[model samples]
Target: MRKKWITTSLIAMFVLTFFAPLEARALADESGKVTFTKGLDMEGVKISVYHQSAPLAKENVKSLCFLDSYFLETGYCVTTGFEVGYNGSENSRFVSLTENYHLPIDLPATGYIWLETTTEDIFVEYTVSDYLYTRDVVYMDVFVPGQSVTVFGIGMSDASSLQLGEKIIDGKNIISRSSNQITFKVPSDAKPGGRVFQLVNPISNAIPVYVSPVVFNDPYQPSQWYLAQQQIYEAYDVFAGESEMVVAVVDDGIYLNHEDLSSKIWLNEDEIQGNGLDDDKNGFVDDIFGWNFLHGNKDLEVKGAHGTMVAGIIAAEKNNEKGIAGIADNVKLMPLIVCDTMGCDAASVANAIKYAVDNGADVINVSLGTSGVTAYSEVYNEVIKYANDHNVPVVAAAGNGDVNGGIGFDLGQFKQSPVCNETKSSDVIGVGALAWLVSLPAWANYGSCVDVYALGEHVVSTTVPIYDLEGGLYTAADGSSFSAPIATGVISLIKSAYPNISNAALHKYLTASSIEGILIAEDAFMLIKEQYTSADDFVAGEVSAVDVDIQAIFSDVPGDHKNVQAIIYLQQNGVINGYPDGTFKPENYVNRAELLKILVGGKGIFPDAAMYNNCFPDVKNDWYAPYVCYAKKEGWVGGYPDGTFKPDKTINKVEALKMLLNSQSVQLPGFVDVAPFEDVATTDWFASYAAKAKELGILEETGYFLNPGEEMKRASISENLYRLLTL
Candidate 1:
């Protein structure tokens, strides 16, 4: 909220202002004066200038021009030439010329020169210039071979003459050509590898092209509706999870030798297996696979069915013709047994958390909660805090108290447990169970504290073997307990893919990417797809840190700008972009089209435009048409009853804030004694948004005014977007 002033120096000011007049003069000739429109003296090695609308004594006559005097401080001789061409529409002629000069090595100044023509006199000023370098290139979207796609050469001068890798195509290959898009077929023989498609006309350098192949090859993936529903399959196509990251299932015990789970279990390489000694001494002796906090040893034998099932949800081996596919295909599961048949105590669970954190667990899954314990205790809170301090995410289950459609069973309303307390650290994600991947399960808890919902009703996963006559090893169960692990698995996938990502960022990514309301399976998948794809642009899995250069993404955002970091973060995450020039234009006010695009793309709230019926009269065929249509379809934004979306109009501060809050499904807080802002009245349309923004601390309290109807600037929106993402 603090303002930072950016000042331009006097030398820079002189260059910009003084160069403008010279550039303008180079374009036009006024008052019958023969002037050098480019500059008084050509300072650069290579220079070209145009004398516009100059009166010529005779048409189509050759004019000889030369620099009157020269003293070279540098080595080469000065050369100058001029050519006269008709101005076409007017009787006046234009003279264009290139001047090349060299200075002697010892001379301090280049001597002045005056030009005398047969009919006129021209004045020349002497000044030393630096060399100029320029490269001409066209931008185009590259596609996979054999696909007819529309590619836009946004800044290309002559798009019609564009060629693909120096090869020209026939008319049959060209679908259509317009000012904006050039629809063409990529030749079947176009090889896929590097992105280098050259343009013939205008002589552009090689341009980058992107091509992605759609592939799904998991053997048992078809049976796992949950994976496809959440679009984990698409995510896998980009990043199928990594084995380097470990997810610790802090629960009862896992069936370590299960056919689907045996290969994927975490092994402490430092500790010798079955050594019966304190090998890699952290605390416990012979903790090979994982520690058993319940028995106080490394015996990981399964006593309860819950832990094994939870472990399978996080990581069951994939493509081994197994019973089911876990959310992550390449993650290592550390089974830390904390309970037996009776359930775990605070002390035992805390120890398990410590064990997981000390042994390099990137993520911890605590699917069990103390249902009888209510208040925050040092024993449990300290351990959870250790995980938070170590940058490990702890996923816990929201207690299952739903009886009558989650009416009185909300976690916020019920304060009956310790581990599931509302006062838990924000690092701990409390997950609620959803039936049919949409509604809250009959036994699932619901509340504002529950960060997200996952499919927990009748969830099928690996379980401990029941050796009776007709029993199977795997089974289907229902509870928030199961949902916690599912959410944990998803987090594990993200963590594995982005190993260096902070715990806070991981939490934000998961919650922000989660689908709201009755989450449609396909919609959830789209959200996951977006997250994975957005993250793909960033460098991941590096040993050190990687900084994303804002200039690489947005040309207008200088690396030294105050808000450049926030702008780069949002831009890399696909949150915002209003211009095709690769410039963010941060000083410009945000428009309705831009806002809707950010909400839909960044928040992952609305589906693609193709899924909804078009209703906005003014948005059809517009660049932001899809976002506008999606917003209207979801009722996040409403148009006039007459059916129009004035998308180009600048969005006000209140309207922008409300749409952002609405996109995240954040509810406005109840009335309080203090008003949110001096300008916001309770009866106003955006009063709730203002109040909620204040309640969330999104709007600064000190020296901050709610300029309600004022247009929101791009820089202001970038800051707000950072808040929304980090929230």
Candidate 2:
């Protein structure tokens, strides 16, 4: 990419040659001299140009003569783009125009130019428009370690009189209009990355502030996506799909009209549009295409939809020309808007469930849930049963409130009114949040109903429609609210690949097919579309179709047994362990860098590690530094800050993945995706090694040359080692 240069003098020469007649007027009116005025200043250089007629104002003429001369000398000129301007009372016949220039446009500062002009004469002014630009806008200037700053800026507004203002850095309001800039110092007690600005305008109802386009080195790089490519890659490749699954997000609603998620939306082909009649006639009226359980109508508004984020989680169009990609790129998303202005009622939620079940939803995603007793008991029982009966699996979030032995029983006893006097439904498949690094968020609910977990930190997703915007895309969110959609996407992947699997069977398979140890056998098979006469009919004895090789998983020792006794014990109790192979090979050296992935696969925990990028001297893109990052964050492992994690050195297998899964009440499987190698055999001391790998669908046959006896090279084992942890 060679830089192109255009000199003003060259353009001037061309313009003079082409438009010689126009410059003839500059010869003067009566005094035989045309006054050349300085309009603006560049650095210390002032620009002077003779006033020319209208035809000479064209770009071709300006570029060749006036612009060419000015630009060649000072590298500045009248930008051929839209500009913002205003008129002042002092100059009754004068209008002031401001030239808008994009940032990093070879300018010394960030400000717009204002030109003054009258009917018969034009002159450039040195005035600049009152626009605010800040370094914080380009870079996420997180409050320094132990600091928490709250930056404020203008939001969307429609009022004419309203103007954006600023506040003091120390939480005080700016009294004078002259003071429009301020910084809020972070309090020592405030936690970093949790605070965001709340911009409000007193005059307008609301205002949508255009995001400033400035690139700055992210202070929180260790926590951003680019730096955690391994975790992203792990989650990406595990349940790879051909982009055809339909994940029905039944939430508040969705921006079904959004460009990214719209293409994959499932439209009810059988229904008619706006005919005021139930063309398909499936009980509800005008569900002609996707029902709205909240208003109980077909026409749904974008503002109230909670399902849009969930839709983004499943398939919000991939690496297309716009916005973010979903977990499953090519999938159909059927949005069932079940919430209104007051939020979703239990009855509405249940109705949404029934609608999704009745429709052809491969996977129904329910990002909302209730832990306390609900007034609508029928909605819960009936909808739960309907979803199961119709073979549509429901992936719901475990409520955000703590729900250990059940709601209101964290200390092992029913201590609150809700639990003491009421009962909650147990049929819904509940999911809880497992942090991006490790350890469960204290606020994340826990209960017997909680069936599984997934990444749920700064998890980005879709937002409802923002009207009249050129390219629709918005990112800023968190919660189990996001986790549920991710799980739903995983379900969609499974269903899309094996569509014939019964909803109940598929549900069982998900729990059954999970990475392992992270969930109980029954937990794995429990909520996925299950078939039973009643809740009580789901007894413990019937062996689930998705089976795990219990003994073979525990027998092998990859390293010293005492080191990772906790992980071993979990495996024995069916908490976690390797695949069905007999080789546990604990003594085999583990790559230090791939630890984050190991935790993801071995413990079901995502990581926030500095990516082992391509440019690093000793680290490659596939190195284990990323895994080590998650390990470091979650108290799983440590590395030299000097930028190295000796990954090839043998790690105590037990001490390896357990550091993350332990101390945290999360559950995952012992399924590492290590394919069988020539020297890495089941009988070679690593019992259950091959079986676990095979069970996890991540192995190659023994004859495939896995030279375990040879020292793993930085290049040879880096990528696969990371995948082994993630898979």
**C-alpha TM-score for every candidate:** 0.44, 0.40
lDDT string, candidate 1, 98-131, tens digits: 4432222122232333233443433334443322
Prediction 2 global C-alpha lDDT? 0.41
Worst 10 residues of 1 by lDDT: 1-10
lDDT of each: 0.57, 0.41
Alpha-carbon runs more than 4 Å astray in model 2: 1-243, 369-378, 402-427, 465-472, 503-509, 512-727
Cα lDDT of model 2 by residue, 548-643, tens digit: 222222355433433243333323222222322334345444454433444333342222223323323454544344445445555655555766
Q: How accurate locally is residue 330 in candidate 1, as Cα lDDT from 0 to 100? A: 63
Evaluate residue 92 in candidate 2 and report its C-alpha lDDT on the 0 to 100 scale.
17
